[model samples]
Target chain A: MKYVNLVVIFSLLTFFACTSSDSDYQVSDIPGGYMPGDTARDFQLKNVNGKMVSLANYENAKGYIVIFTCNTCPYAAMYEERIIELHKKFADKGYPVIAINPNDESEEPGDSYDEMIVQAKEKGYRFPYVQDKTQEITKAYGATNTPHVYVLNKDRKVVYIGSIDNNARDAESADKFYVEDAIKALENNKTPEISKTKAIGCTIKWAS
Target chain B: MIKPMKNVNLVVVFSILTFAACTSSDGDYQGSGTAGKHVVGDTARDFQSEKVIKFPELQEYITTSTDDKVKVINFWATWCAPCIKELPFIDSLRYTYDPDKVEVLLVSLDFPDQLSKVNKLLQRKKLSSTVWLLDESDPNLYIDKVDPSWTGALPATLLVRNSTDQRIFLGKELTKAELETHINKLLN
Candidate 1:
């Protein structure tokens, strides 16, 4: 009788598990892409200033704000000033922004290294505007959208991943600052309540 | 007689298989009614009626079907090269399939200020399907509500038939054959 009871309980548990998972299966839960607590690997790419930048170079940094963005994407352009603000606000507080353009120049000539340099100069970017010439780092980070961000700790662990803020249309109207909140959480040595989010962005133009 | 534990195990396995079988054919059902007859007329004139809608309006648009037609909601933007490239393929479904069966809605993700650009492109492309610009200011709020699987990437599509409980979300650029395969799967 006990064995029969045990079997019934096991079956019920298994049945419920299957149904629950099926109903709540998120596409983001699929493999690839970083979830919170995932340790991100370091990358080496050239900056617009003719210098190679990497996470390893930041010896005294508490964490890094690595953003995959490019020129010509209107969405990215909208976030340009906000990204600059993030660096200004947090760079001295231990987290600095490292912008990388992952688009292929062949596909989007405007996103070429020279254009990145021009944009950075024009915008007075205080951060490194690097070029992911190979886009291998982009694949590793699983960044599908341009202007996608990954907030990492000193250990290179991804603490928050997604858009810069809640509002992409008008920055002044944005109520929630996702990246800033994540950085604040890290500053307090507390895990962010909301770690992952999604934003509409230009699909990272892959080389033909 | 078989042992009680063995019998329970058999029941569990059988139930799982039955559930799987039932779910597999859930999308395979004959669509009811014929209300999707789209009038063959001026393509640009039809597209001129496009409007900007909020997220809740879009939700109602997807769930509440006008004719029990399968909803092919393609989320695209004018600036997205691949999305522009695939617009014709998605638009092709509007004329190729029975309007009473499949209702293709090209939902543009363009900013409200870019309405003119969207209009010019649609007119240039001669796209005939109904279009709407999702006016939600915050993508974080609406992106997941569409489908948790979506990463907020451009050129995503939602194929849904609520009456039959079928919702297939594709978050990548699709080819012509792939779109046809999905439509056929949803239809029959």
Candidate 2:
């Protein structure tokens, strides 16, 4: 009986040690984050409207444009209009936008849930603007930067992961519409030519 | 019963090894780029200077003489909070060491249109280091061009010694002591 207890305790300790946040490593050093073609896990996160929103709720959705963004980051702010435009373009085509704020309130007070409500209202966000309070979904998706995007097909397989476009500085000047191209490929039942790209973005303020 | 106990001990040992490997595997996470592209020991790309420096001439600017001095290039922006917090210590590096021993370059990743914001911060900070605003427009092209390991995060630093072609890329903000240790390593 004593030996059984020891075994159980050791197993539990090891599990938590691996799962616990190790913040020292660079964002890329984070292990087991979702890559293109990998299946993404569904999540039930709270929207600014105080309702739980999950991908399962969208039965008609051919896919989802899940973005990990926050109100505080300037980079995120730059893409806010673009994100709205993304929803407007693709929502009717069966891909709805789901915006999640991954920043902790303590680290960035502007990213708090209440602030999200204000921003959503002010921006007249047509899509579900959610908050990942626990950040489990954010960690599961391995989002390092504000406005990080992951496009998942109906099968929940991530087809694209990157910035919304090549130019975060200016939307009108952006030549590469990465997310749009990916969704367009999916609509045509073809593989996206480009699956991944990177851009300079604010680091998500993780709870220390 | 005794056999099961031995198995448990073995499992524990294996788990500990796995945990240790995860913690120390920073070097193992190499960039997924082609070989010899922006990795350490290779010449780093030149920054977007205020004067719009092109290549060949820009190469001369980034590559210091084999005078054994370490060049510290820090990538930051005016909007990034942590980058602003660490600017003072990074700026102090200029005063801490003789110009012949260490050189600090502050590269602003701010958009070309936001040049005024970058200048405002520089003026307020009274930074003595040379400042350059990145002239590049698209990040997807420049991010990997800068370093394969870079995920386009702010507060990234690159320490290089031109003489030996030795370089270290730190992807996070550094304390003054930590910065000195890396510079000392290159200097020695």
Candidate 3:
């Protein structure tokens, strides 16, 4: 009788442990909100010179292309030439490409302001290479990955968010240029057929 | 009576075998500290935290979950920028929610060498949330175990409320509004 009672108690404990809680956790899915018509949030990030720059600072701009990049991501490095091209193609036409390093220097020493300067100088980045000192601007823009791109209209709202293109692992078969298409559509005053995409790159490093 | 005794002996042998098998493999984490130390490469300064759990039975340290509370599990690395940016907001969320109804667990991915840095950051920020350093070494083996599709991203968050359902967010940062909205949705 004692043995039977012990078995019963053991089974009851197992059942309770298994059924009482279903709080098994997994990694979360990407947050969503942006679409073809969403307006971009205004931001003030410190430039390489330590001056705060905001959307209002570019008063006469037609559009803005904000790219969340870093000094370390190989994928972002792959797109450096493309980024320069975009700035050259659009800055005089009223759309200026802005690059922001959102990696925390405390966690990623290579992404420090001084390193950013060296990288910009080496790559000859003509556009503003801003530093998100506290990463407030990066979070405000909903940028989750390095090389995450956001394109805004003249009124400063996010019209496009995601990768520079569909290709990152290989350049030989690189076909889609999503950011370019989005900018062209914005220039033509039409909705982009594809407004968002999944950015593939290194995860943003946060400070401990 | 002899035959019955023989049968009883067989049952006893089977039970012992079963117990041995279960206890030997289940929760028997024998892989202790083979994850390689971070060597500075061309990319950046890499710091890895120690992986050996000094206390083998530390799993018992987790408190029992309450019925009314929702637990937020955040997997982060000290070097991840978005994780750092979103942490203050997460702290703010803890303050905003009722303590009895919400719990936040911050799991650090720092190398064992950086425990001091992690502790210092927590102290500097005055974070009161429960903090734990994940002592597993092999991320490639363990990352998928955490979630098959995680892709080893930092600033990953898991929201749980007693096994019925859970939500995962893989990204760099989250705003207070975003965090609150998701928490509310999950509670409902």
Using Cα atoms, each model's DockQ against the true complex is: 0.28, 0.23, 0.05
Tell me the tens digit of each residue's lDDT in model 2 across B61-164. Answer: 45657577788888898888899998989988877888898988788777554543564466456554777666666777666545555677788887778787
> What is the per-residue lDDT of model 2 for residues A22-60, given as tens digits with 9 covering 90 to 100?
212232445467878889999999999999999999999
Q: What is the interface RMSD of candidate 2, in Å?
A: 15.5
With candidate 1 superimposed using the best TM-score fit, by how many Å does residue A133's alpha carbon deviate from the native? 2.3
Return the lDDT, model 3, position B21: 40
Give a tens-digit lDDT track for model 3, residues A1-208.
0112324433554565577422112122334434456776777877776677787899889899999898886557767777888899988988899999999998889999999989888888888899988887776675767787889998987788777776554444567778889889988998777776664356877666
Each model's lDDT comes to 0.78, 0.75, 0.63
The alpha-carbon RMSD over the true interface for every model, in angstroms, is 16.2, 15.5, 18.4
Which is the better candidate, 1 or 2, if ranked by TM-score? 1
The digit string of per-residue lDDT tens for model 1 on B1-188 reads 00112213434433443553366422111122222222455332343346778899999877785566788999998878889989998998977799889888889887665655675577567676888888788887788678766788888998888776666778888898888778777787
Question: Is 2 or 3 the stronger prediction by TM-score?
Answer: 2
Candidate 3 residue-wise lDDT, B35-122, digit = tens: 2222333111111212224222223222244465677767775665567777877866667888777778777766444554564465
| Residue B185 CA displacement from its true place in model 1, Å | 1.8
- Write out the backbone clash pairs for model 2: none
lDDT string for model 1 (A1-208, tens) is 0112324433554565577522223433223656678899898899999999999999889999999998888788878889999999999988999999999899889999999999999999999999999988888887888889999999999999889889887788888888999999999998887787788988888887
lDDT of 1 at A20: 52
Candidate 3 ranges with C-alpha deviation above 4 Å: A1-36, B1-188
